[model samples]
Target: MKRREFFKKGTTAAVAAGVIPLVTASCVGAKDMVYDRKQDKWFDLGTGKTGSNSRKKTVAYDVAVIGGGAAGICAAVAAARNGSKTVLIQDRPVLGGNASSEMRVHLNGVNNIKGKAERETGIIEEILLHNRFENEQESFPVWDHVLYDFVVREPNLTLMLNTQAIEAVMDGDKIKSALCWQATTEILFTINAPVYIDCSGDGLLAATSGAEYRTGREGKAEFNEKFAPDEPDGWQMGATLLMSSKDMGKPMKYSPPSYAIKYTHEGGHKRRKFAGFHEGIWWIEVGSDDDIIADFEENRHKLMGYLHGVWDYIKNSGKFPEAENLALDWVGSLPGRRESRRFIGDYIVSEKDMTEHKHFDDAVAFGGWSLDEHNPGGIENISEPPSYFHYHFEEVYQFPFRSLYSKNVSNLMFAGRNVSQTHIALSSSRIMGTCALMGQAVGTAAAICNKKNVLPREVGQKYIKNLQEQMLRDDAFIPKRPANDPNDLARKASLIFGSTTSSGDAKKLINGFSRDIDGKNNHWQSDGLSADLQLEWESSISLSYVELKCDTNLQRNIMMRKDSRNDELYFNGIPNELLKSLSLEARVNGKWIKLGVIEENRTRLIKFKFDTIKTTAVRIKMTETYGAENVKLFEVRCYA
Candidate 1:
């Protein structure tokens, strides 16, 4: 049968049965093999072409996430974990977007804010922690596989790699299905989902779905943004091709390709910098003058030429004798794009929001990166600095839920660089860490939308608090936002500490503030490693889940940096304060019963879910720490 007919049959059966239909790998040819037209009609499910290739496959899920970057990964993972069936599609063979081996741009997040490290928590941190455990060599190729491993482990998530989303089928303002093309498999994927998240970085799905969007810088008067241009313009930050070099034992000779552009110090324009050979060179940029999306192929060529020219200058020009022993190890074939189409939302984040550090009631994410806007001139103009660091905040600023979902497209949401933000505000929030948080927020929101059968805007309006509380329960931190879940039984119980007390009160455990937010004191500390914390109520409370928030030392960098030393490797390892072993027990009819026990716990936030039981009192026994001599925790909650 034709693939399209098969898909139609499968989808019809699945809808009647009220279940999702998956295209199993066993039913298809091996993923690595390219299908031949005549020999394999079943394998070559062509992309709507005549004669040989005129078939497509259809699938269904609760949420569909387009793009497999950090943001998309987090969104899909979050959505799946929150009880929604999710699908993630990436055009590339591997994930990680700029951080992948294909692009080689270092993954960056909320590393530091005002001299204090505030590493982003939740799914992004979990991925980084997993990388430290699995990818000890810190190899870029290995990192790609690590992400794949983390993603596939979620049984509720379906990942489609090497698949490009070409069309978005819409019903009114809702995205009914996203049609994708997988060249290798020659399969057309028609993914139907209730909620769709556009993490494609370029906002392709949102644009195709007719989501309202903007392309370039907004005028200062638009949002009272000081960093915006005096007048609205089409100019945007350029794309870049990152390259890396390694030091050989001896001198190395270089020969440029016939098409390589020759370079000299004069070509440097005095603005392009060549330093820190171990770190990837990120200034080989171009393509802001033309259409960033429409002229993608033309821009990539210019970026590639500029990359080769910069390398040629470093190797041939005698300006730097220190680089004689260094050899080019890698050059990215794909450009790490910076800016493109940004979908419109209920609230547009402006430069003023970032500079003034405006805290939003609906905040779901935060960013601390400085406002570093690259010059529009790119590699062609050398007179000015590569970018302008126009503004810095006193601390990290929060991103509201209003900027995540499409204003017109009811079921559509977006993350990464495509979220609803003015060009000037995007300069800071565009970092991967901030994007990851946005992804988590939107993913969780999508799950909620699926559960309630509502639109994205409805989620922000009615269930915004519920969504934020869910994120907190999952260990995601929202700046200035406190968790006040009414369902938590511990919030009403009496709290007691069994060890040395910190300056803060033990009541902070039930205060709803998990992380350190807005200089608020909402954490409890013990003087020694082994401590017992308990919550007691007058009457029996039936609970099935217990969540504990332990301190994970956010003051140190946990991510891998390109120029890190051997001694600094420990920073990527387990945090010293994390509780390695713990046990939870409840008093049933005046006798203690073990509810859950954990060993080798590596995460800052740990939750124990078991069969529901009635208990008058519950206590947490922490016997070991990752390395620290004391046990410090932020919050503990029991859910009914």
Candidate 2:
């Protein structure tokens, strides 16, 4: 009756009977096992194959990612980087499902601190940096290639493009394998893994494998979410087919397709064009509120017609003087869907969690974008406005790890827009940046689970805490602050340097360093530091070590003097002669502190220290001899 023995016997029996086995009594215990006589298998199965009749293939992986979007990519990279044998199965020919180059939708996420640079970390960050370097500006196709290159180059990652995961194989409550179809070869291959992640934005794997999920919005009372509708509504946000056009100098004749005119103005105004309008910003019209997968064909035809009509209108009308030279540039091959099946995980993140800024015990990621929900119906229904709710918190709110794994299905974890969150909550966290962070968390968690041989739900907060710390070290920001207090101070100092309310003393010091000098700080004045100035001085002095000193601890104040011409330097501390024989470097606390030298002026501070004067003088002489020309000395006052 031991679990291992039972699993062995059960698997053997199922294989002999040609039946697909679901859960093994050994894994879940007899009381938890429910046999399905009709299917000739155990209930609560994750793998698609049933009874002995199903095809079987041998494959093994440390971690398996079921989608190739932002989440899947991050998850796979994190696992691989962490030394896990990771495999990524993507249904599409190219990566970047919604934000792909073929789809041509810009990745949208609010930069940290409003004006700070975008958060780029892990594999996704590398790709973004490469793209920036290659294009100098944003180019969708180039960005896509960079993403592709990142995955392909990773040594521990196995990327199976154009492969669809049709079924998940489960041993008791854990996923053992997934059956995927290779589009090119039409061969079904099995991928076995100790851990699996569901990044398919549609929750395809969770649904097919019997993972518990929800398809529509929840009632307001369930989670006490203020944004939820009074009653459960089946309606979900619509999808859009993005379009683009180029200037052609003269309008070209075009014919409208039959379904292009589906919308007639209720007030008797002429119908508006829907496609071939402008560049990147133009989005064509199509069906909404209807079944997206089922009606996709009809919608495509209507969109084509709309494009033709738009071109016709441009040729015949004189409204667009600037667009007279426009021509059809490109159109999206697939529509970008915003909402789909939301899997029910161990925890459901609600709007209240976001609005109230609720902090979770197992926080993994943070999101700051506003709650922006597009209506279930497409653009035609302009009678009602789109839902827009902003979080009151100036900082990003933390998301818990529980929301990433399914409550009913023990093994599966999900990320991206399909994470276990209500529609309103998803509106804010669904952005690519947040999703990338979630992906990193999931990948790291999966690796931990695989190494520890524990379920993701059972991994506990300590593991998640470790993962968050690692993420911060890797440059991905989470809700929590970093451990290094000095880093915090340095960041604060950087911000203060550029602020308008900077003190007169601070401004004088900044200016004296020469507003735009190179390392020497001797070139043109007021030009500001050149772009090549090394903010990160790997081979130079450590800026953090530099500090100001005063003779008296109680009255420790230094005045920075500025001349009428706005060019001067002054330092106050112990007089220079007192410490004349001490060899002291201009380094503050072992960090380099540079003072721009004025050749003809007496603009240097005196120094004094309690230690032997010889050692201090030696340090100073060494610094003055080898330091860059811009380096200067200031009075070092001994405080008692």
Candidate 3:
């Protein structure tokens, strides 16, 4: 049978009947597909001075992650690092969807919760810290390069820019291939994988694959969401055009463009006050209830007009003299979008799940951002507040694994704003940081799915613990869940102690809680610098790696903000509590032998991997920190 015919009839029937007695061209056989510049020859065409060659390329990966935003990057990195050959496809030249240099939106996670930040850990934390180390100047354009560096350095991942996954080749309910169009190269790409992750906020691939999805706001009756609209409407949260102004050190004149609408703010809501107009104004936005995606260009023009109008009001109006020296420095032509299609999953996260702190047995991630529901008609409706700021969370809540995968499509998964959630739930969970946690969870789960040769649902159903444990081992903090991997030698050690302790017990390191919470200490704090923490096993065990989750002060966020706001809640620079110098030694043949050393550590999770050796005891000597007088660590893990 022809490839297309087999895929359409045979593969579809086999998949629907829950049988796999078809030709090798099915999903399982797709791994044999390969795409390298060496193999496919592009024939020379005499159509133009430069040969215009167009061909289709089919590349196979274990995981195909669509989008290159914070969530997509984290998902791709997590999947790649967890032993999956992954490919990350981005429509834009740069990564970081909303937080990119193009949008200049702040890469915010759980910035503030009850006066302290419950910062996201794992891959996302690593990314934020990477930026802190590399982009000290806090330049947005440089940050673009930083994100690019983060993705390209991953050996197991392939990044395709200027590529859009417009269509999906379906085998029954599963996505067999994604046909992506690369505008720059003018090449069509068919990316086949066992698992397809739609981290793109709009979820084009999932939508094309016939994955069930919902758009716009959900009514209160749908999920008993207190913060949801009283009656369901087609209104999706708007997108905002951002602009930054600079102080010219002299009085600057301003003029409104022809497209600029006249802004009076005459009947504006009291909550629409512009406190930080020097930076971008978040209220200069627009939304559409019906087909918001189709209204993107239309709203974008209005956003630009509204942005300048608001600026004109701020500069010309006699409201205040604060804008005398401020001149418009940077204006974003592309508006940062917030809401889009939310794909259906086994479990739809509702407002109560977050507000009531509902715990899920399959919990693999956490989120704590407030229910910040943007008003129906942003800026256009001046009577209402820009954001309702519905509800604030006191503590982080668990996000279920069931909500990360598609309900109808067997192998499709999603993260970011497009995940399975109610409109009210998205209000809080839509934060990039929270979405990143979900990304890591699904990415790790995708690797698991590939290893077991199973679909996403089976992994969540039977091997959820395995997925959760793997994520925990990688330093992902799951709320209300502690890392208890049986393979961790640190937990099995006969004795674990510290050289000095200012507060908290040394045994807390083995307790599995990687962060201090609920007024309970889960860390080992040295009274002063140059401390020794050792773990001894009753019997010698073969070890090759020692991982430690050092102190980075999770309470203060380290994400790059346009204002570079430094306060009690946020740290503009690197955390002073991070371990700067550390060395690991193994007690081999009764004598201590130095195994590895880290002179300058940038990651919160430090690793010491070497050849396997039989050692009864392991000693970690931390000599210095960035600035803190003492050194602290939450957990220590050893693996073979």
Candidate 4:
């Protein structure tokens, strides 16, 4: 019998006998079938190939973070470090969604905003500083391990790689557990948690949990955005398959595959650009006019053909002599998506909120990138430019806590490209650096919720100050606002200086400005190498933790780059102005007692913890800096 007829007969016979057989090409020869008791079904996934015996597993945590990209990484680390048991679930073998080795897109943030260098701080800055300390070469694969190290090193975080969150176990409006399928181990994971964060760029977990969301471009009349189209349409930014090339120092041969596309100068020369060979090409994109989520596989296949076609043209076309020795080094298999389903929140961010700088009382995060909109035609249109610049912001815009949580679902919250915003607003807020800040905000809020035993909405309404105070204590910056913790014991005490400051007053340390920005002069700088700043009170008080905000040079860049190096920013060693050695002390019974000392400090925020004691005075002693002669600090606080 013919192949088609034989498979059809086999399928019919299996259905009649109440036994479903693997007849399709995807399930042709799989003999291993495991029955899931919880799901009450059978799965024929190819997990035996990885050589693992377990087929099912269960776990619990205080918080669960889905999608191990920039937002998810920050969320998991922030939640874990803030004293919450957190679990991170990732679908890919490695971390970093778009900036990973699998998809080598540059992690852009407010750096590209106008011409000023405004880098994001907090957990994102910590990750970049780690990369600068370890991966100096800026290798993509090495960057993957750098992200891995950041997640695994956290003591309270549990990372589960190669696990895709397939289903959401919901109880009424809350997510009871996240059911994930581990492809390599062939095991199903049911992770239960009180709070859930959906940092997945595509909003996969939100969609499965019945969270209301919006997709496609909004009409001009909807949000009154000038850049929006006249009518609404199901069009989104295209997915890109970034490709990189390297010179072999010798000639390399090339041949086109059967599935590769055929292109000429008339088809792609005028529209597409191929100037840099070392970095991945971002123009070879697809899937703007089609459904990005429902038709993901088809879109990815089409992008692969287009990518190979571009490479073929560069090598075989013989148009440029620079391509003689250059060969394709890496081509991404996974397409880095730009836009998809966005959860609907209480407030939908509009273009006016970004351009006019609207005030949000519960602002947790901010963004400053330009409104960059890509053409819907994608690669199919060669008549227009690949992108259209809509508008730029005079200053950074604030993101509200109302826009970060679900309006319908009680326990759901999201970050990254899928936040609550219109299409025009998303064009600016979609950058990875801005997304990282949102992750930090939501994660900090999640920790507060777990501690107080309240939902996300309650945190926004009643305990907003608690969330803001925690973020500032952890070194996160809130635009136009200063950290003033009323519960802090240092706020009620008097501050004294051991020595005079040169540039600014020593009283600036208690003014609550942690970062130095334009028109803001609140930092205290000492005159000489070693100086002391002491906090004294009339009566003795019990203290356990001391938080210090130092200067790490926020005006310069510290991230790893692929192109030419900027020695001023991306140096081989640590920043020159960072404090390297410091010590904390307290005076009890007329004698100074050393509490803690740090010989090597690499971060902007430093915390000293010791046994609780009643002391009348606390002192911070500094000895040496990385390079600067004078010691500079932003804020100092004591908590009991």
Local distance difference test values of all predictions, in order: 0.81, 0.56, 0.88, 0.80
Once fitted onto the true fold, the runs of candidate 2 whose alpha carbons sit more than 4 angstroms away are 1-57, 111-123, 262-277, 280-292, 303-318, 386-393, 484-640
Candidate 3 on 250-328: residue-level lDDT in tens?
A: 9999999999988999899999989988888898989988667767999999999999999999999978599999999
Model 3 clash pairs are none
Residue range with the least summed lDDT across 10 consecutive positions in model 3? 14-23
lDDT by residue (241-321, candidate 2, tens digit) is 766666566755444556554433233212323323464323344434423444567766665655555555555556556
Local error of candidate 1 at 237, Å?
0.7
Taking all chains together, the TM-score of candidate 2 against the true structure is 0.65
Models ranked on lDDT: 3, 1, 4, 2
What is candidate 1's lDDT per residue for 558-586, written digit by digit as tens? 67666653342227566777888999999
Q: Is candidate 1 or candidate 2 better by lDDT?
A: 1
lDDT score for candidate 2 against the true structure: 0.56
Q: For candidate 1, what is the TM-score?
A: 0.89
Work out the TM-score per prediction.
0.89, 0.65, 0.92, 0.89
Candidate 1 differs from the real structure by a C-alpha RMSD in angstroms, to one decimal, of: 7.8
Candidate number achieving the greatest lDDT relative to the actual structure:
3
Candidate 2, residue 49: lDDT: 59
| Candidate 4 local lDDT, residue 129 | 76
Q: Per-residue error at 17 for model 3, in Å? A: 30
